[model samples]
Target: MFVLELGLIGLCVALLPLSYVWVKASDDKFRKLVWMTTFLTLDLVMFGGFTRLTDSGLGCPDWPGCYGTASPFVAHAQIAAAHAALPSGPVSMTKAWIEMIHRYFAMAIGVLIVAQTAIAWRARFKRLPLHVSPWWPTALLMLIGVQGAFGAWTVTMKLQPIIVTTHLLLGLALLGTLGWLAARLTPIPVYEPQISRYRFAAAVGLALLIVQIALGGWVSTNYAVLACTDFPTCNGQWIPPMDFAHGFHLWRALGMTADGDVITQDALVAIHWTHRTFAFAVIAYLVALALRLRGYESLRRPANSVLLVLAIQFATGLSNIVLQWPLPIAVAHNGGAAVLLLLVVMLNFRTASSRPGRAAVPTRDAAPA
Candidate 1:
């Protein structure tokens, strides 16, 4: 506890000086700082995926520290004991290092959010109306606290799949929130266009994709990626055996039956199969949306971003199965989910801001559609 407290305090102390220099740099420096923070948060999200993928989530077996130390150096003996006690268990020196690194990055992000909140509040009297409220960063700070609790539960609960999946989703949610806020801070003007009749459909599609992402997270957390192990087929058949009830038993232990026994093979298959089945729907919707948005110059970047992310997601998802769940591909698959979430959030933001006659389109005169 002392270690975690010290680390957090050090993070705050470090940020104050850096932020002072950044804010004093120029208006552009402020923008760059926000973007740098945002980018690092995105990287942090990816690193988080790496940690979870490697099953290092429980490395420290505690929150904000590894065996009561900020770094694994002092906790090395404790980690070795835990690892030797269970050779293939969750606690090892490597895993402890990964976990602590994640904590540090998370703390840094918290600092950035704090800095953003301060800047937003100060800018209110200094000509930046959008920065006046600071409500968004305030909300983010609260959400990060909740996320931290979930992180603790993730370890204490022994990596219960539901809690783990929720943690993953929350990270992506943070990414999306930051992305939207960053977009708002940019000089890009919002365009209120006469959206086509498919706006409702697009909204629906986006919502469904988000839901599908949750399902994917569930599948990953439960270690169900290899349950099926083949593309377009599960265990060499279109429909393999499944036990949805047992598979989705949310209250059960990680990879265990409701009775505290190890989970059955059928349950794993059930979880994996469900995600695979739903993915087709997600792909179709995204492809169609991408094709539709291709002709609209304003929507092109986001549209292409969606398509590119979808392709990367599909490839990485397949790679996870074909490569026997290699760490890189699995981590990439998780990162792709974050990327897609950000893209969808941006799409939502663009569509919302593009309401008819609400704001002028940015760069309208510079480029021809």
Candidate 2:
């Protein structure tokens, strides 16, 4: 397994120079291209969420190569057989398509990261720093390798809740990391002196948001979203019966208790209820942070965007439950979370890069060009 993983890394390394050549060969900004790739990666993460939400993780029922082919077009017979055996289960042509699409996007992002790393190294050898840390690319490469392993486990382990939720968190971490790299590549104008003070708060907010997102992922992956199905009250009461022990059981297989018996409604309810309550904490912190960021000129746009995305997330989240997890709204809710993640990432990067205290003080104004 490790050897195959290294072989994939070698492939990524071999593609790095091509990114450099392509960037140098084009009139487009490298940073902008990176950001574009990052955006697509974010979309891929959302689609991955959709895949898991729809129980399509096993749609293809295979590994890196879907059903022993590059796409479902070549594996139609196999998919049909699996689907026919279990009409509402995880195998189907549609599911295979979704799974393959997710892989394609992952490969593209991996290619981009490899390219970025190569360009940085080349630029470094030329006695001009790429102005960005090569370690960022290296870290991305390593993280993706781990993500691939988790992806494999997600299928092999039959979508265990903890593994799936960790996969989701890993995707968010990559999004934020790429967003930070993109921000570093292209400078943002800073206008405030007190921006440094917000850095600590922003850091804390990001941490809290990550935890909340993890809980949400756990709830969704465990099929716990509709456990309660009521607002301001769970099943018509504030404190509904909950077997947190079973619900929080981390090592159990999907739809099964720790003892291997089928899971109960109370367990799902415990999972769903915990996520709902955590939502309150996440929203409150993000809203407060957004309001604080409004005081900074450079951060106002991202702050407003954060607020808007949160509002959309709230609405979509409710719609998912009220509508019994309709596919569209559920997908949108997932996408909204990705957008919020990127927005916060950008804001944090802006705040860090603009810290007057850390930036080199201007000794003299550059002579008029």
Candidate 3:
């Protein structure tokens, strides 16, 4: 089984040659590869959310494959049996496909990261406009390896809430790492002017945004989105009876409270309510960060990015509650959270990319050119 799985991963890795050849003629090959990985990571996060939302997380019911087989081919008989037994349970033909596809995308990303690590070190000794620290890709390769471990645990642990939530957090962390590396290695932007004067504030926003994402992940993993079933106020009340102790317990079984009791309605309400309330504060702070960047020409693009994604995030979030947890909107809401995250990471990277000896990127003076 393990050998077959390794071959599957190798098959995905084989595609990297095509991508590398396409970028081989470029002046900066590693830079393009890192950006491509970032793009795919964003999509992976979205599709992973889709799998969770559609209840396909346990589709395969095993780590890395569907019933000990690579493409769901050999597992057909077992999957059909399970679905027939439960009828509407987690395992199904369509769902197994979703899970496997998500895994394939993940393997492709892993392969690219490995290739990136090799290229960065190899190119360090060659002529280039900028020098990339081998540590950047080296560290990224390590992080993604850990991420792959969590992916396996996510299945073996049967989607335990804490385990699953941590898995999601790690995925976002990987995205941030790639974005930061790309910004550092990008020859053109390495010497560009810092976009935000409020670097300290942006850093704060990034930290707090991470906290907000953790809360959001908790909401999703616990399947608590519709607990309130109304927007602006939960269940049409300013305050609802909630069990925070049970809701916030970090370690527990899938649907059981920390005390091993079946989780209560009040606990679910608490999980949903805390996430909703905290989101307002996070949204406001991010908007402030975006507004501060509006004055800088170099920062305007990311500033607008912050605004646009935040708007979509708010819309999708509200629609999730009002629209009764529609799959498309929920998945898009997850994607919106990720976009908002990457924009902020990019903003931070831009502000910090000005190397010490190389003077800060010059700002556009108000005087006419």
Candidate 4:
């Protein structure tokens, strides 16, 4: 019963953007829907980060609903009992609201993706000039379903570090895919033969970014951000003592070793240090890639976006360490990563679509009236 209610809520939330695109777009409604969905997915990713950072992940302690209800309001008595039992623990009215709101937003995004898939198939059946294949949204719909499953697991698994980290990765993956889809729908004029040469480099940069984000997610999920508490060096040592064996153990519960023993400070330090150290390499490679892409006028926008977001990421990341991980800066850091990923995905699409002899083609589908 709660599941159906939740689905209805999601549908209601999704109608706003769907109606906007349907009415105001006037043309290229499909493209507008894709871009709008991409924007909302980015927001969902950042809110997911906030949910994790604020320890609200287990606030509801149930899947797809708060205490098996569609909204947190009805679960107030249960939440109050839990909070009364452990005032500082994971379950609280505020945290429950935060967690449920995040879930609601995610469900809404799921609804939007379904609408996109339906419209794409409709366009295909009518043999419209839809520039991109309908299968793209179909794939996005499938990916979002997997992401929803992981969202449930992140709760059912008790916020296990690996599960939470994987959830973050999958969310970002969905965001990146939507970005790619948006790029495909909106054509850019690219004539540079040299741009295609950077495709491999762009791919490598994106791969490295994914790895770095995974490590960062590991750090966040494990609550290891403040383990080092220093800049340029961890814990005032050029080389800090670390327990990589325990820190990198994938299947263990949160803050515990593989043997079910409580994790040590060294393990936390290990997680934080690895994320910090690898960040330098990721930043350097991406900066160089952005500089290379800047030489081409057609690629300049995304290239500049990369550079700008990279700078914000560096600043926010450093602030996370030196400023003791303020919430705003931390959330901004997470958002910066999402934005950077979007830019890089766009760069990859542009480079791949623009070849030596071919000019970038716009979507062929005429706007449906």
Best by TM-score: 4
For model 3, where is the 10-residue window of minimal lDDT? 360-369
Give lDDT tens digits, candidate 2, residues 66-119.
667766887888889888999988898888888877776677677777766666
Best by lDDT: 4
Two-way TM-score contest, 1 vs 4, winner = 4
Clashing residue pairs, candidate 1?
A: 191-354, 192-354, 192-355
User: Model 1 residue 207 lDDT?
Assistant: 86
Two-way TM-score contest, 2 vs 4, winner: 4
TM-score of each: 0.90, 0.89, 0.91, 0.97
Q: Write the per-residue lDDT of candidate 3 for residues 1-369, one digit (tens) a residue.
A: 764775667565648653554556565555667788898899999999999999888999987777888877778999999999999899999999899888888888887888777766665655332356667888988998899898898889889999999999999999988887766655433344554356678899999899999999999999999999987888989899999999999899888998889999899999999999999999999898888776676677888999999999989999999999999999999998888899999888766654355433333211101
User: Model 3: how far is 76 from its true place, Å?
Assistant: 0.4
Model 4 misplaced stretches (Cα beyond 4 Å): 356-359, 367-369
lDDT per residue (tens digit) for residues 1-369 in model 1: 666675675586448545554556354544555567667778888999899888899989987677777778888889888999999998999988898888788877877777777766666555554432568878888888888888889988889888988888888778888887766655433243754444676787778888898888888888888999787899998988889888988888888988888899999999999888999888999889877866676677888988998999989888888889888888888888887877777666666656655343322111001
Give per-candidate clash totals.
3, 0, 1, 1
lDDT of 2 at 204: 81
Model 2, backbone clash pairs (residues 3+ apart or across chains), number? 0
Per-residue CA lDDT of model 4 for 249-356, tens digit only, reads 999999789999999999999999999999999999999999989989989989999999999999999999999999999999999999999999999988887776
Candidates 1 and 4 compared by lDDT, better number:
4
Q: How are the candidates ranked when ordered by lDDT, highest leading?
A: 4, 3, 2, 1
